[model samples]
Target: MSSTPSASLFKPLQEGDPGDVGGYRLAAVLGTGGMGKVYLSYTPGGRPIALKVIRPEFSEDPEFRRRFKQEVQAAQRVQGLYTAPVIDFDTDGAQPWLATAYVPGPSLAHAVAQHGGLPLRSVLLLTVGVAEALTVIHGAGIVHRDLKPANVLLASDGPRVIDFGIARAADTTALTGTGVSVGTPAFMAPEQASAGTVTPATDVFALGQIAAFAAIGSPAYGEGSSHAVLYRIVHEDPDLSRLPTELLPMVTRCLSREPADRPSLTEIIGLCHELSPTALHQGEDWLPQTVADSITERLRLPGPARTPQPMPTVAPTPTEVSPSTPPPGTVDPYAPTGLATPSAPGAPGPVRPRAPEPPAPGHHTATPGYPANHTPPPVTHQPSAPQVRQKSRRTGLIVAASVVGTLVVLGVIGSLLSDGGGKEENKGAGAPATSSGPTGGDGGAGAGQQRKDPKPVSYQGIDLTDGYQLMLADNPPRPVQSEDAAYDGGDLYFKVVNFLDESSIGTDNGKLVLLDNARKGSLETCRTETRYTEKIDLDQLTQGSQICVLSDAGHVAVATYRGRSSESDPGSYVTLDLQIWRNAQETDGN
Candidate 1:
């Protein structure tokens, strides 16, 4: 670790940075970027580390979150001589974060700015160390699209590469399309600028750029706007005039315009040995005398360099659960790519189909929840005032018809009496019937046969598809097309822009969840003509939250999530409970 005092290494925590993230107590700002913020924190053992918390905007992006989760999972395989490996990460949180072992050192950018270009010996050692880092990164099937002075750390022990294995290889791809490539223009290889195929060679090109920067204390492509720098990288040759004669040939080969022509990492390491001494190793003084002296001086000083740790109970670990059990039906987090794919923009929605008969309540489906033996009940939304009003109206109509029938029967009996009990024809026509089978004239329509199930003003609906089933990625909001649908039916066809994190709720971070109800199904089948998206705050919900999706045929599709099917790694996608309400009137004004 660099001996730099905490004061020099960290800045005071600002308003936006959280007091704590996951289980780590953030102490100071290590660095900030457009994508995320890196904070200085420590573990339970008092070991200092760097914690990177993704910005909320990016965290809300389903696509970005999915890719980031995969990258973090893959990153665990890397353990390199000169790379700061990620120690842990939370894929199911509102603010996704990852912690890496801290290397107490200044960034190469800072190092070069403070002490001028690294000496020839230091440059060779730095190049070799970073090359070894790349080999490990590539072994994990990752390419570091961004490699520059800021990413290279001049640790007292050796140079450690930071922020590796986060970007992807293809997009519409020349490196720019993947949404993962955030490469700096000056250091970006020509192919990256042109969106060419990114491979391990792409990283080698970046390494060459870093080496040139360290040699001359400036960029190989010189300085200008990002566009100008990128233009130079693609159209003009590198101005390696400031690079020393000894290291020129190797770094030049690394900067080859064609990725196929660039030297491999192993070849670059070999060339480093041929050009400069390789005696440098961990704990050896490899930095320039001034830089080394500055770092060594801090080791002799004493101050409160480490921040204090949080109490044991402040931020609970994932393995632990809250005291009160969540009402049964709490389910796994939302899967962005299940059956809920968003339709193409401006495409008309499909016509509504006659909804199939849904299974009775208490029948568990294969969603992310508890084991089959512990199938949780479906969540029901509270009956609203309008629903009550509709029920009353129907009751009044039935009562009025019953009164008229009773009066007519009495009048017939009176007429029989008036005729001195001799009117046998009228008696047979109004004769009461005996039940041979059931009520309503021998099974014409029994009470049991009559649909007694209450209209579902609000209830949980689940899609029981298996996790491996493929689905759509996104669907824009659309309007309901039912001619008899409510005036504000379009409002019911809401498009869920962002949702609250519903992953095993009770976290301070996620109090609300947004859902897309209208656009559902895979590529071929979609429930298009409906407008209804919902936002539910998990913290606020005493029971399961209600997600009311308006249907095309003047109805509402209400769904509520419950417990998981099995705790074992709940498969690749997420599950939901869905129930469609026909002739829905509760949300008419809305």
Candidate 2:
């Protein structure tokens, strides 16, 4: 290891800080975040590690500890070439902490802030590494909800994604409050901004934002107050004007408003591959030279120096005596003792033992005979014979249950097949004696005719600007200005010019119907016959009210009114959660 310390990379420990924790000596404070502080330390074998110690407030909370323990266990199972795997953790301690292999490099955020944006080639390579890391992370059933530039580190090998699932454990706690979002506002996906369901796709949206940030040196949505940025993310499209030409398409697809519209991690890797075939193997030159130099400087930092505690001497007992033993405090002349024998008159007659030195405050004393850097092996408990037998019995019961469940499933399938056979025979015999149900096919089996309705596409928290019309028939619906929304230009129009009294949703050429009792309406509820009108006043409708519409293009849509976009700014327009069924005529037989 290189022994050149860079003062910039470390800060001296403050007063009252522990010198040693769980056998790892704290060299310096690496960094601090909202949740806790990170320290640079070394393992028993002299391997460097980044140890994260939880803050007292978070550790003391019972709920945080419970969630933290679960997250730690799951994190330990995450193993990826582009990730720093958890090597050790202590969740049940007063202050829960975990250790991971130290990455001697600056974070992407710091690198970019110190230097400018990276070159196109370096950004492509960074994408490949992070995408690969996400693949491994999601495979382990964990989402890296916080994938900002700060959570990505630039090393000589490649980019490493850190702080994977830790954000989730801190989410919805008293510290953050219930229903509050848990990610950086600049990089948050639209769904996250609206309190919608978050999934793996949420990370993909953040990934796109990261790429834009790396190539353009600023956030996709211009930086400002959190509220303003979130509003843009939910209502406005990202400003990709400054992004590199080659990266625009991939980034755009990843930033699609609907979660279903974003590309998968696999697709992202393929796009990176197309841009640079050898992106993953760029090695030390993957980062720009200036950033690479920073990594070099960090690698040269020296390890923490630990003072070895002196071992106490004990008189030999009769059971430990042997023929080769020397007299107390006297060295055998023929033996090659490393120490010099006391022969001078003024020399001490017998070497007097000194009391062991007390360890520094907040520091644990080193164990006798072991080096200061040595860490004892962890203790493990083995199951007893009785416990093993009990486990075997439980396994047998589980196996028996599985067999019974399989038989039940098979029987159900056989019965369904039998019923289907009877129906086919009746059709062949031309038997048509059945009571009529609903007027249309309605995705039901009617008189031996089997029909299925197309699945409705759902979009949540879609904002419609005042005076602009929304095109619900579009694959992923979009908004169009009123002038462009002529005859068949759009589906629903937001009329906010007359305030709450006259503000309503109306189709210029089609029709609208209010579904009073169907607040939780779906495609089935929309199929029932109801009076259709050109417009429905907003003043009479409350939040959570449902409106079914037949667009000018002949497509059917169910819109749930989600109230105005901003309560403080009444002119900001309203929000709607929508579900649209395309080609409605085929199902309705109109």
What lDDT does model 2 reach?
Answer: 0.71
Tens digit per residue, CA lDDT, model 2, 1-590:
33446556776566566656676667677888777889887766677888899888778777787677656644654678999877666666668787787898989899989997888889998898899999888765567788999999999989999989888777756877643445688998998889845688999999999899999888999988889999999999999998888999999999999988999989998988887745356588888889998998787644555333323244434433232334467544433222233232111112222222332211222233443222323235453222112334778989999999999999888856756845555444555545333324433455445444556776655556567676665433444446653434557888665443567678885677798763566666666747888878877688888888776554788888888744322134567778887766343335
Tell me, by TM-score, which candidate is best. 2
Least accurate stretch of 10 residues (summed lDDT) in model 1?
470-479
- TM-score, model 1 to reference: 0.51
What is candidate 2's TM-score against the reference? 0.54
* Best lDDT among the predictions, by candidate number: 2
RMSD of each: 21.1, 22.2
* Model 1 agreement with the true structure over 423-458: per-residue lDDT tens digits: 443346555534323111222333224322225432
Candidate 1: residue 350 lDDT (0-100): 23
Candidate 2: stretches off by over 4 Å = 1-3, 178-182, 277-280, 308-590
Candidate 1: deviation at residue 58, Å?
Answer: 1.2
